[model samples]
Target: MSVSLRVLDDGAWVSVNDSRQVSVSELWRLDAPEFCSCTVPDFVVENFQSVGVDGRTITANVYGQCIQCGETGVPGWIPVGRLKNGEYVDLDRENVVLPAHDGHEN
Candidate 1:
């Protein structure tokens, strides 16, 4: 029994055809006791030149290995956002189908 997801749809993920893309959720890892001010990982937008503000969300790209297989298959993505209390939030979603970067056709 496989379940599907969608954006502006229902559940955690949105289904587009046979594949599904879920809005990744992340919990910010605060090094300091204060939540209002925290540092984010670099990979979470290292490729981008600027950091844009989107409502309460701060989008970024991150890198990590698969915990299960220990394979460097895909780099994890981090979705950062600020809470009403000024605390930062970050969540890591694994195995995201990222855009192809190689010269080969996608």
Candidate 2:
């Protein structure tokens, strides 16, 4: 099954499959060193810049500043929330796996 997500209330809520699976405040807790090429301790997500569905995974383009270097903007997509078997998980950041970026696109 495909998954869809949307940013509501200006990142206040992330509607996954027409249900709120995660919130902006909770995004702050997500941190994956392999996702971005930055050395920041964590990506402080303040807003949801965009959202898209990729196969069975729901991707989210988050806009936030780096907690360490202060770099701001959407670094890339992160899978914070998910919906599997019609069950909602409270927190699921471990499954966030970013595709290898070899400094090439397309």
Candidate 3:
């Protein structure tokens, strides 16, 4: 199976299969100590710098600010969603604490 992943609208949205599936301005809980010192940084999504797929997981290199520590940068590839049977499935990004993937399996 194949999926089309793209960063669109000047890095404001993540287009999956040519359709806008994710967007900026969302509050995401992150477990990224390398990006910030906060135990669980309250990340505010500002841009979708890039997007890729790791197996069934859909990941994104996002540019955002940590509301707790005010740290801003790309926290590596963060899992934004997943592919189930070749269909994109949205993750509960806002409610869950997403871990940043630095190219290693997690």
Task: Give the Å error, residue 57, model 3.
Answer: 0.3
Model 2 lDDT-worst window of ten: 97-106
- lDDT by residue (1-106, candidate 2, tens digit) is 5555577887877787678766664435334465445643356667876676543455677777656666667666665544568554544553343332112111
* TM-score of every model versus the real structure: 0.27, 0.64, 0.95
lDDT of 1 by residue, 1-106 (tens): 2222123322333223234332323222322211122232111222221122234444333323333333322232233333334434432433232221212110
Look at candidate 3 and tell me the lDDT of residue 80. Answer: 91
The top-ranked prediction according to lDDT is 3
- The clash count of every prediction, one per candidate, is 14, 0, 0
Model 1 has a clash total of 14
lDDT by residue for model 3 over 24-79, one digit each (tens)? 99999988889988999899999888898888999999999999889999898899
Q: After aligning candidate 3 to the native by TM-score, how far in Å is the CA of 27 from where it should be?
A: 0.5
What TM-score does candidate 2 reach?
0.64
C-alpha RMSD for every candidate: 15.8, 4.9, 2.3
Kindly indicate the candidate among 2 and 3 with the higher lDDT.
Answer: 3
For candidate 3, the per-residue lDDT at 99 reads 92
Off by over 4 Å in 3: 104-106
